[model samples]
Target: MNLLSAGLVAAVVVLIALSAVAIIRADRPGGAWGRRLRSRLLLGVPWGTIVSVLFVLAVYLFVQRGYWHWTDPVTIPFRSWSYLYPTGWLTSGFAHAGPGHLRGNLQATIVLAPIVEYAWGHLPQERGSQSFASWRTNPWLRAFVLFPAAVLGVGLLTSLFALGPVIGFSGVVFAFAGFALVHYPVATIVALLVSSVISTVVSSLVDPIVTATVSASPPSAPSWAGIAIQGHALGLFLGLVLGLAVLYRREGRPSAARVWLAALVFAVVQGLWAVYWFRGGGTYVLYRGVGVALVLLLALLVTLAAVASERPLISGERSLIDPLSPLQTALSLALIVGLALVAYLGLGPPFVGSASVAVVITVALRILYTVVVRIAGSGRWAFGGITRRHVAITAVLLGVALLAGPAVVPNLVTVGDDAVPEGETVTVEDYTIAYGEEVPNRMVSAIDISAFGETTQINTSGVIVINEDRHIWARQVSPQQLAYSGAVRLRLGGVGWSESVVVRREGWTAVGNGTAYQVWLDAEDTPTQHAFDSAPQTATPSIDGRTVTVVPDDGEFYLGVERGNESLGRTALPEVGETESVGRLLFSTERRDGRAVVVAERGGTSVAVARHEQYR
Candidate 1:
């Protein structure tokens, strides 16, 4: 290493060592910090959290083949696309899109999951329970087996019930936050900040220094545009349910106000409040106000569900709770979700349809309340043995239903129709890669859904890949993405196999008109295919009563001189600083005003015709 770099590394090592020594001294024998840690943790370490993070990292490096292709990995087959695709459902939760995605999730998991594991504890937490009394209460079993097993189960559940084509460990990360928030509400928020700091530190260590200059960057949607809101909410609700049950069993409670504030802050900062809808053709509409209000509602509902009193909402003389109450709550939750799914499929705009479903649920709940009051008036069973806690729990379940129910309709759909657009395509076994403009998106059109005058059948432009067998229909590269990057390579694989498809676009922009371009696709074991072509573009410049046009055909570009559809002549476009003649028009490429342009002249009068399109 260089002398300066070596010195920096040594300095960092010394600082870390000093910090460790200080911590050890402060936590010496009988120290308050040591005793406090022991109360909630084994050896002041969260072993379950450590193992869980390692497990997720292993999946990324090996299963996703990210070790070889750190930034680009085979992700098409790993997405939770449809119920028929069991491989996706089984693996999608652990798989990630790329290294940055994996790193962000792992950082959050490492920082926040420890709090949850600590709250769970290696020691038995239930009242009157002793450590090592049984397999359930064994410290080793809980830390190494039960905790990891539950994480895996929850990961699978998130994938099974998540919305269309979701991949990443973020849903599980949100679950960790939810569970931690219940026990240490304020501490969970603090951990969020700490996780950000850890991410920054890791990034600094990786890069050390950076250089930047003012330049145009690739066009991209908002970062929150693509978040899987449904999956995240489902995970959060699942965690909250589990956390509340554990808290009740252990006879421990945290402040409701703290829980509410923590939930709200976490939701807002983490972008759970970014409610959005796809507008197709590479666009989206974010409902910022609505999302913020929903965050408020979620916090309130979670607070109530976790801390509401155990007293019966209706005064009762009966000493025993109704045996059917639990069953009724479960059935109601299931029924509401079913109705919401049906409504989503039949109604307009998903958000509007979900709102209508909410109205139906409210009416149904009111009717149930009326029936309970009438039955209680008869005094057969007092208040049907329903407590405030039961009602609060039901409200929480309903919120979960509202969050996850509509996702079912989209997940049930498959690309049963022709997915490949009619054009030149390169086929690699079951996969077909093609490029087209203004073609209907098969993923969105698989089912007819419309909202805000925008239908799911909106047309998209760019590279598309399809695999009917795996229920895969994806726009791998968008028009803006390809236009900005000039080319892209994507990998498609399943299990232990993988193949690559390369897409390239070349275009020349008219001086004042649109660009003419051609797209090509190449796949393993297949010849390079001319995937798409656009019509000739005419430059808005008249030189000596003649106009120049750029015509792209069969992977070649031509310069044509025409006057009102009467072509004077056509010739191959010349290289930069080269000159070519077309009939009476002289065409020469030159650099003009920081732009490469083609100049057409005849007899001293010259005009700029077309400019070469540039991409970063």
Candidate 2:
């Protein structure tokens, strides 16, 4: 199950468990509240869905109609995933481009969400005795208002300017997941657990299986996969911060200065959102930009809470209550995240994925850094040159960097005429020498293509799109050369060049456009079509030659010795007695004796060699 499914299941179980436990024994405090909960109720607009759809549409228009108007989902990611932000930071969330990505997110939302809405809608409200009207606001009102805004805002902010546009409601769904954690821990835990099971299908089980079977895995996630761990991390982090923050502010007293600091950040974020809003052209664009504003509001609240409590350095406030007291803060965070992750793992559909355990650990470390930094300083806020907390945080970040593995940089090395070795890894950091020839245009942005002679499996990928300027050609060189002979193969730093299969010249002469393309052989039986406009003056290419240079003679059209046509068909074997003599495949060859066959065409006839293998 993914986080969503886990959450859903846990919600049901909790609703039932709370009742079951109550039936057997006298009610505990809040037992009546539990009794009132029901499922399948919808309140408010499907605001989340509407927001999700708008983002999907806006992103589509950006890709389809925006200046960089290459509307293809694959290419948006192709340019790079990290660069997707400025063009769409907000727009990525609006559209599904396809049904599958859309349906999956909707299922998770609908299934795992009822408990949350019910809990929010039914929470007991505080009443004003007789003066004003009574408002049905629960202790959760602060959390409800701020949580979604924070999650959406943070996720969008972090993921904006990512490699390409992404679509899905996971961010908002997760926001609810975060809120559910605070209100209904048991239900949330169960939901997360189920979600974990479903999530495994994509991350651990399904992916690895296909990869192992194909003997392959891609570098980084695909552009269209809509997997936003970074955004998820931000959402999860904010949910955690807000859950504790709201209670800390309400239950604890904070100084006024800290509140102001929080307000300042809010204003800044709002200004930025407004700028984006005006720049965006449509209703969808405006709505997405508003999401950024909502995010700013949440950030402001967190800042205020932080300042009011005890984090003097951030809010420039003197804490009246030891900055929210470390224990309360920890409890608040634990109270929310613990319940949420559990439900996500238990009952949510597998679509709600989790980060690496290492990353989760990183979250704790980051929180610790903030805590230590606040505690160690006794003097004025944030002006210290080097506090113990800074040192600790630095140490942790540096450690993570060191442990993450050096990102590999790729370069091509030629062994000989057409052979590049495989399985060797190199980083761009390792290279110092300059280029001998102009580097291939494709490699300018780090695309690596080591192409070869034949064009078999190479043509099958939809990823290989063709515009007018694109063309494919054969790469032929010997593996025998000294330069590439010692050179190594590529590995995935998960970005840029480095292919799974290395092309050796001795293999079928595969083809590519020298750059920006991936090529591979689909058949070994295929002939090496060495087409020429005219005859070779002699056998110009010799075994001893390093490169065979071909030139056309004036009006003297001739080709090398007889061989079946290799260019126009997918299969290597000719179609029984088929010939390329006519413009189409309608003409067939008639076998006369045995050596060759006579090809009958519309106006006349041509001959095709009947190679022994094709005789049947």
Candidate 3:
């Protein structure tokens, strides 16, 4: 929602309101085709808005040479035909026109224009001839086509996945609206008439489930390779059942079997969906069972709504299962709100005053401990001294647990891209996400400490991942902290700041021109100690590509412009007869006006840098 789009929406609202007044009051000439096409939407301002956004999006893509893309489409390097041997098939899809082009795809289900004709099937030329009560007719032709078109519009299918480039509104827009085909108790009107508050609340609670499923696996199975499987699959299932039911009802034939078949098909599709998701290294915990329940619920609702509309819609008209009633819902919400308030305020650990998942895990651990104790008491396995054996085993297990416990604590952790559904669009404390796109908003940031001390040099360079918004930002070169086991973490809170945090490890480098570098490390070598700057802790800087001993045994020191670059000549100290002369003379600098600046010192020796800049 930028400035231009906001203006467009406002304009549309005004125009649609005016149009609605015209159709009812002003003399309008629509008696046949024009009246039918108008439906209810045409008599409002939103329709005008739809027209504006569609027009802008179209203009942005086909013309203006990629209005919002990071670069021109033609300039995207990997997409060129010549690059294919080195690059794989994903080169095209991964290349986006710009943030706006990508953002449109993310908003697909919420609002994408309809297609001229849906890919799944057709709408009858005649209307009211299609009452949504019967099931044999095809209901989804418009919705199906619109979704793929929307997906393709953003290049999700065509450029990235193998099966498409079926991008655009044809799939998602239809898919979102397509839900009504199965749930056509005229949910919009009914929901509004009942209460906007309930509808809004229900939508909020359930939209995540819906978004999660469609994002996990879309319906166009062959095309969704390497994408979230469950989301797409559910979207496809929802669209299909809804569309078919509407088609059937309008054609005047409805069958219960058709609705049941929709569920069965969803189950079968889900099996394949799971296999693909797991094969691609996704967590089974994240995307299972949700899709099945959604399809069944949707299919039943579509059927019930079609049946209920003609008569007074009654609660007993369709059976409600053992459900968590409104009271329970309110109570549960209250409990969660309380917990969230405590956690967000940092009042205590998140599980404080709650019997949460943490409590469950703790109880399970306790149970396991009791079982183990009972077994140990029997002394069945160990022959001579069961007590001693148990003690030893317990000690070893405790030691291992203590050593590995940190792994379980996600106070800070890395989330692999495949670990969570991309659709969840998980947010970290430091950065914001572009909704469903899953593209990182911020990549790199760091800290600086050179201003603190004299003769304290902090030379650091390494790749570091840092939080941009939070204080967790990383820098290859900066003051940092180190863990010394000798100290207590609880007593100190955490390792306080030290000097020279290694942003990049020796082998791998940070990413940027002169900022990021590649670190080349062997598969199984240990990380080197990160250097720390201190009270002028004299250490050798490289000299002539060789490490110079900071203080030679003979009490001598060397000086050079840089440690490794040989172009700078070195001033070697003559062999000292005693330990009195081990340090080097210091150097200072001066501006052209003869004003002293950047003072430096070593061994009580100081020199002014009055030399020209060209001298270096």
Name the runs in model 1 displaced over 4 angstroms. 1-6, 316-384, 452-454, 524-526, 591-596
Model 3 spans > 4 angstroms off: 1-33, 43-175, 183-225, 228-329, 332-467, 470-616
Q: lDDT per model, in order? A: 0.79, 0.33, 0.30
Of the candidates numbered 2 and 3, which has the greater TM-score value? 2
- Candidate number with greatest TM-score: 1
For residues 118-217, write the lDDT of model 1, one tens digit per residue.
Answer: 8888887667889889998888888899999989988997897787789988888888888888889999999999999888777756655566999998
Model 3 clash tally, residue pairs: 79
lDDT of 1: 0.79
- Tens-digit per-residue lDDT, 322-390, candidate 3: 333434433433454334433422332323422342333233323433344343343222112223323
- The weakest ten consecutive residues by lDDT in model 2 span 508-517
**Which model scores highest in lDDT?**
1
> On TM-score, who's better, 1 or 2?
1
Ranking by TM-score: 1, 2, 3
